[model samples]
Target: GSLEHTAVLALVLAMALTAAAPALCFAALAVAAGGLGTAVFCPGERRSGAAVFTAGCALGALAAPNLTGVLTLGLAAGAGLLGFLLCPEQALRAVFPPPATPVGTQSLTSAARKLSGVADTLSDIAETVNAVCSCQMPPRGESYDYVVEFCAQHLCQNCARRNTCWVQGYSTAMDGLYALRGALEHNGRVELEDLPGQLSTCVHPADLCATVSHGYRLWCSRRQTRARAELLRTALTEQYSAMATALAQMAARLGRAGLPDPRREARTTQLFASLGLEPLECTVLTDLAGRVTAAVTLPRTSFTPGECRALAEEMGRICRRDFDPPEVTNCRTVTMLHFGERPLYRAVFGLASRPAPPETVSGDACRQFCDSAGRAQMLLCDGMGTGKPAAVDGQMAAKLTAQLLQAGFAAESAARLVNVALGLKNAGQESGATLDLLTLDLYTGRAGLFKAGAAPSFLCRAGVVRTLDGASLPMGVLPTVTGRSTALTLDVGDTVMMVSDGALCDGSAWLCDQLTLSTRLGQSPQQTAEAVAASAVRRSGARQDDITVAIVRLERQKS
Candidate 1:
């Protein structure tokens, strides 16, 4: 290949040597070096004699009749010959190294100015707000005459030692309230007639409610209980009535402040003034009815929102507050929703699993997640078919649902996210799964149900079984989905049972009968769960698919 390449170069070189072009002279020099190499390296190679080559070039040059051209060509050829004789890199570096490019002044200045502009803009925004986050924080509170550093530890409303006192005081008060409620429940019923007789033993109203037992102070029998119960009830009633009234008035004021009247802003301003804190343009969703939600705001001073929330909760111990915990936001703004008198509930859960006829991995997936907030979410996902492939779909749906719920998504929202994720996943796998989710508020014993093409779930409360039918297409079956999302009470000792469709191969009535029988037998929740699953398996017999059952029993937390 190089030999053919050399021949083409040699032909062009010969033509160039006959003219006075610089490129031709360079070509001639390159051809001459190749000839010399061939003559020296290979003796058998036939080469054009130097005398003949020189004569031909001379004749062509004379015919051109251009003395200046002849001189230029001779000089060019000499230079090219020298280049071939020398190292290429050294020669090129010395004669034709590229020039360094200079940076443009205009572009450099513009870039610096642009960066500076952005920095200045950010600085301005920071100046406008008290504290800034990735998402915009509301602007700082306006200047206040009474409270000079209105948002922080230096508030005029609170004395310097107020916080220290408040923290310990609130905790003690809350503890007292919890003790009182526990006492009242333990007593069962109270009478109002023997107030003087009940007060004889207990020194004060606080002592009456908080004291669980006494060498005779805690009324043991109904005969001894009523008189003291009546007195304790009367005392508590007299004490808390004023607190309740204050809470109601405060709630009414908050509601009115949200109205369109011109006095609304003035009222809010005055209210915050009384509280000794500067008023924000908007109180995060708002605080009302004895429950206060401190929207995620930077504590301007040493005072923090959590502390304020704790104070509010302590105040609410006297009266019920409606606290609806805030949903999670993208800005990661921690919002606290409060509901008075709803302490997190405690629950016990049990689950059972049985694989399809011959598959190693069951096509059913069950999961339960409980967060520190006493929020619990349970999921039961059944893939369309049995085996590992179907099992993967079920697991994916269940995992997504559980994770989303833990991340503070409500049942409906988490289900929607799972539905979309399943839809996206379906592009690669044609399988779809039924999602049955239960989110329970341990505080209120309230459970929310979200289902997509799921089987009927059962709730056994006070020995009565209620079936919740979930009518919808399986996840990933439709672009726009429709499913059941409902909330209902799951009081103490109530059991919520969920199962895969395979468990109900025949009808729901059989399972209900089994549940009722188990309830009547006074079986524990774990035993009940096992019995329910066992019954379904026995009913399926030779035609079993994938059987799974999960039961959650709500119970009041022990003191």
Candidate 2:
């Protein structure tokens, strides 16, 4: 009796210990068993075994205490293990020997390949679905129902494997379409008329459905959004291309007529009209048969003899004329005069009268110097912000400064007047304007620079560059802001560049490089300015910003 009881207790203890083993040990054993089963069975048989195991476990767990009773009846498991151990070792070895042909491993390789392929397909589908969700298309009433149907049909066709992925994708797409339809229908009635456009715009419906099916089969799968963005980018590029083509054609058609002088009155009007720009107090001049000409007078600040010659050559090219002789014909004459107690620089050229005969300087000194100097006065004011308010403040400062300067007031006095005007306009808002006032005096070969909260003007001379800083606050904000005037003496080969902060900030280095290159190339002031402006624009890639520049050169007359 004692021996039997001892044997029973040992067996019960062993069974209980095995049943209560740590989760990891149980999991390992289960994995080993599964691997053995997989090795013995084909794919279909393995799947069947997996299904039976899942169903049995579910049923046993649901049966509660009955599972314990079934597990306690371990005689069958013990007998099976005993039989497995007692089986002939030679026969077992023969049954489990490595395959002679590597082709026998095709089952696993084929399954792995299919699994990877399905995973990739599912990933693509998920990306398509996500893209559709993110799409910002306008709602299309009952057209949304059609979209759902379209997606469902594609999903069914692509994911005919009847996997959970297909069902989930179909359901999700349908739900989305229903929501969209509801929103659209709430606003108005849905119609089949809108279905075509919706269908056309729906991207990769079939692929999305296929992905859903594949994802359902895989243990883990993730959904693709870059495709939609790429499509948008492509569309934008196409639109730009079309616009550029049309514009190029138009420009070519306009260029077919005879070249108009950029410097003569009628030509200036025609040129501006052709370019769709506003008319200014400028003229365009052309040579014989209107082939070559100057459209705009070179600003005194950017004028240079080389630029003049280049302009003339450009004109000659258009006119097919011979104006190059004048370049060599007039390179030795020099002239000098005095203005307001300062000796003025001068360069003479045969193209125009050889230096105006010295006459008594009359009229308002500032106004006469500005008007008769063959130079334009420009007052640039940057307000505190963008939009209407800033524009208004900036315009006020510019207007007042121009008015005072044109009325013969000195630069300092003009700046003071602008300051006063701004203060009156925006006394309480703390709004102000920064000023960059430049007076190009071609007659005196000087540029009067006045600034109030603006960067110093840049002067390029003899291949050296220097900045002239101004010490003053912007206008309007302060009750009274004093400004000082600085005179920039010009030479035949010197250039004075004045620009607003907007232009300078956009491409200061490129502007400097362009200036140096233009000077080296011996370009006229106008050419240098235009080239610099164009280069700056190109460097900025057409980032729109306010741009302004003023250039002046003096050319000696030939002996």
Best by lDDT: 1
Q: What is the C-alpha lDDT of each candidate?
A: 0.55, 0.45
| lDDT by residue (tens digit), candidate 2, 356-446 | 1121211000111233224546555667654556666766566555554543445665565455445544524578888776676544566
Please, what is the TM-score per model? 0.42, 0.33
lDDT of candidate 1 over 221-298, digit per residue (tens): 433345434433543453244234433543453344221212222333333334565432322222233223322211
Top candidate by TM-score: 1
